[model samples]
Target: MRAAAGKYRQRNSHAIWRAHAESASHPMSEISVSATSTVDERPAKFSASDGTALTGTWFEPSPPRIATTVVVIVCGAGIPARFYHHFARYLCECGAAVLTFDYRGIGVSRQGNLRKLKSGMEDWAVLDIPAAFAEARARYPRLPLGAVAHSVGTLLLGAAPDASRIKRLIFFGPHTGYWRDYGARWRWLLYGVWHVSMPAVTKVVGYFPGKRFRLGEDLPRQVALDWAGRRRPELGRNVEEARRFRLILSRYREIRAKTLVLSITDDAFAPPAAARRVLSLYPHLVVTHETIAPATLGCGRLGHLGFLRRPASEFFWRRAAAWLITPNVGDEPKTTTQAAQSPNR
Candidate 1:
């Protein structure tokens, strides 16, 4: 799908990333404790299959012992790993190790200029996502793997070499990129932003300056183009030279994880219609499709990017984490069954 909007009071958040990066290390790094004092955070680095360097962070239970589960946060199109920190820490507190990383040419993994970075959505799906899974498996062997994919992150999940290793998955605002599927009222406006103006602007700047437009971080030229050009309901391009794209979608069948596809009522970018199209691609998985109305959660509004943000997290984050640690997906967790109960305060 497209990059989500809504920064949730973000102000120089990248500086926080830089502050942590100053003391980054291999596998492990300097630790910082969350306000809850129930999670331990550390910086970690790894490389993609193509030897392109990537950066990530690990969130573990307060005492920092190895956990029985690892939930990798597959970020959306232009958003960085930091956007999902709230969700990651919640997973950690629930006794699951969480891994959140920036895709190539994004956030901490960004190198040089993005326009020169030749990677596109396909590169992220095949090279980067697999590498992330590999890194997680190598670091935490034999533990059950899970993922929380947001927006285009859902598309990236299929081509991962370790897709079968994922025992549970949560598709947050998952959608197949079909412009017609946008919510009725805001359809044209969003289409104008993502499909029309985005490409035009990216063409001039040599990248998608998403932050300038309040649409998450800037993206590589091809990443924006890929998002813009994929107007069809399908996963990838439909013409010739797309054999590789077809090959990537073919791997969708490999993912047999129990999944929960969350379609936010207020998420015009990813209505249930659009999210269902993504679900259609994964026929082999045991899946549950849930449409969450803001009123039902008493949050007033939870947009495409709001699930992991405040207000919503205060009311819903823990319940979502509860699903990841459930025995239905993996082995027993160190935390109590209360972890799976309703997250309402």
Candidate 2:
């Protein structure tokens, strides 16, 4: 009986799935990692409920092991899908299929007039995220579906009405854009530039030329307004945004998934206070929070975007891979904070 119980637990642990994705059947798309392992990258196109065309790439483990689950890598605002390809490939190597895509008006999905595109941050949450979820479900009907969202991606995930379909979730450097939540060293600079300068310039130019300024990708007018305008004591910009705030507040309860929230210690946008605030929204989730410093990874900084830049062989990357395969042990939200020290330490 004890042996049987151990076997049951092992199955529940999701240990059965761990090799990264590949496709030997399609030699043209196969990426050889070593002599025996390979990952397959394939182009995918889907449409949001609003009928907006979206393009994505699928990284799948091939030959020896079929993926037991699908993990979608949700990008932060203004970040291209390619930024996550390395991480997706890492997850594929670890045994799950991964999908990474750009939101409308960004990366591969960008088209038409930037100033004229009606895709806002809200539209991304309501339409694009769900579309990705649907795409994953359609491809792997029996496999468990999960997501790893970065920065603003968490906000978008919580805002998605169909986000509950996700079996598991990981929010990296999660936070709402509260100016006060920024690190003191970068607080006012980020505020004056993102809020005061960017929004003002966005209005004047009809779109934010972030590509020119090195802030990030060029953004649609509404996306810039929706992001940069989230400030002061209240995050809502107007009556429409006030409604969205309330809607997202409630939808957080609907997204019932085992979540791991990873926050960097000195993340300018998502400090401990901000991470805690975002936690308040997800009353129904089984959340486990961890705060790590860049020093632990032997780096000088990991402020906002640096976490994604880190090599996938690192401890935190493996931590995320383990979480993707781990099932819920309980219903409680555990803020079991830990500082991830280097393996050398």
Candidate 3:
């Protein structure tokens, strides 16, 4: 068993290395990472409920007014929290405290020789997200909290057991029915590859290289497994977990917080119809929806992940700032004060 595992590991590792090399040789020029402005503040590392240390940066509002509310930025599959740095800073500048963190066993938080087990989206919903939310609340107890989840993070957040902690929720490019949109054949093929083959391959090969493991880039084996096997609702991390994509559809009605759903018209991962379905689930909740055009934003045929990548990102941040600061009864009292103070107009 050990020898077989070793061989599989080596093969998968080599495959990842080759892909990484190829990507490096011909890097895509869609968005330049350095193009966006940087946040001057450095992130502080903190421990989660499971004792896993996580990295996060807190953005204090500009002009340092008394903070009215705080925003927690949750990134989607495989991405590090650093990708949301620009957005977080924009929220802070608009007078809302912002906290962005890397989920456990991914990004910089993967340090300390953590075990590489295959985890599903359910694990994130049950363990990582809840712990992160709890930590954010503990750290900023005095301030009302809002959450902005992107992609897979949206599913996990939407399924959270304690949605009351969040005053307002925003979903950016949420993945409502990924498997269906990708086609049944593709879904089955992925299931066979990721579920039946990947775990066995990973067991034999010590670790899968970063690039081949996309969703939670550089994700641990356990996380990858959870993501792959996350078909049945019963297989989710928490017992009360919403089972299946249909369950997610139904649970939206239970989300008590004011919500906003944002999607790009050209986003392949989340089409306009999918965004509409998500909103439809929450008819009673105060909801706002917007569709961004890539051409107008100077983003060429931008899709799901483009919102954070580059030149087009300015528009996304601007929209986010407006949505977050706009005074609704659900907004923090201080948010109203900060909006009034803004001299940008």
Candidate 4:
């Protein structure tokens, strides 16, 4: 009986899932890492909900051991998954399989012409997420699944139909992007970026020229329009749009995974308040929340996108791996104060 218990414990310890999301609003350069060093990464292909062939890279653990968990890194709008190669390889080094992919009309998922792309925000949230989940499950059957999302990526998970399949979730700088969530410090800048800058650029190029601005990859016209429209408080106040919003919010109940929400103190794109608001939508889930000041981590001014890169990787990334593997950290529901007590540490 003791031996059996020991075996069970060994299996259970590694058999957990983690999903991570970061708020999307910054530039991400291509991640440079040794391709054959710690992980065996290769280009992979999977089908989207509409049967569109989506391209991705899979990072499998070296030495070829059975993986107990799989990590799916979801990108924010206009940001390709290639920028997350380092993060994926890091997770692979931690003894788990990792997959990163571009959503439709972004990065490699864009097949021929960009001008004719008809995808929108809803397609990304509802369809692309489920497809990614399906691919991960197919590759690693019975293993606990995890996800990491950036910016709009987290919102997409909240809107996914297969969200319940994930056992663990971690979101970095997750926000719904409603204009009112930001404070005066960033309101004008955000307004100019969303309403003025993006509109002018999209009008000229027929899509958001995010690449030229170093905001990541260029975006489809409808995707850009959808993001711009989200700036309004009511999201157009129309009956159909209002109903759609209700539907998306209602899907949060399906996400029963234990979640950790990380917010940076100085993130102008998705501040603490915005993170808190996004968490409120998932009232049914047991979520642990943490607000980190970059100074505390010695990673000076992490802002919105710095956490994914180096410096913070020393402390923050390890903590994330720990939380993903350990289910007891946030097993019980706690208040915001209780959740902030360095449980991940």
lDDT (tens digit, per residue) of candidate 4 on 186-266: 878897888678877887889898888877788888888888776654434478888887877667766777777777878
- Candidates ranked by lDDT: 2, 1, 4, 3
Indicate the TM-score of model 2: 0.83
Give TM-scores for every candidate, taking all chains together and pairing residue i with residue i.
Answer: 0.83, 0.83, 0.69, 0.84
* lDDT, candidates in the order shown: 0.73, 0.74, 0.58, 0.71
* Candidate 2 structure quality by residue, lDDT tens digits, 1-345: 000100000001222222332233531232324575568889989999989999999999887778878999888888899887877887888789999999999999998889888778888988999899889989998999889998878777877777878888888887777777777788899899988998899999999999999988999999998888777545466788677688676777676677777777778888765665565566666666667766556556667765555331244567787889655433344335332211110
Q: Could you say which candidate leads in TM-score?
A: 4
Give candidate 3's TM-score.
0.69
- Tell me the deviation in Å of residue 230 in model 1: 1.7
Candidate 4 wrong stretches, greater than 4 Å: 1-36, 234-237, 332-345
lDDT per residue as tens, model 3, 192-305: 655566667556665444456554366666665555554442323455544454465444446666666677766665655445434444434455455666665644566777
RMSD of each: 10.3, 9.1, 13.5, 9.1
Please list all clashing residue pairs in model 1, or write none if there are none. none
lDDT of 1 by residue, 1-345 (tens): 222111111111111111112211321221223545777799979998789999999988765455779889999998899878767877777779999999999999999977888788878988888888888888888888988899978877887877878888888888656688788889899899989999999999999988887889999998888888867655546666366666766677677777766778889888776775666666576665567777665556668875765445543455567778867543323232111111111
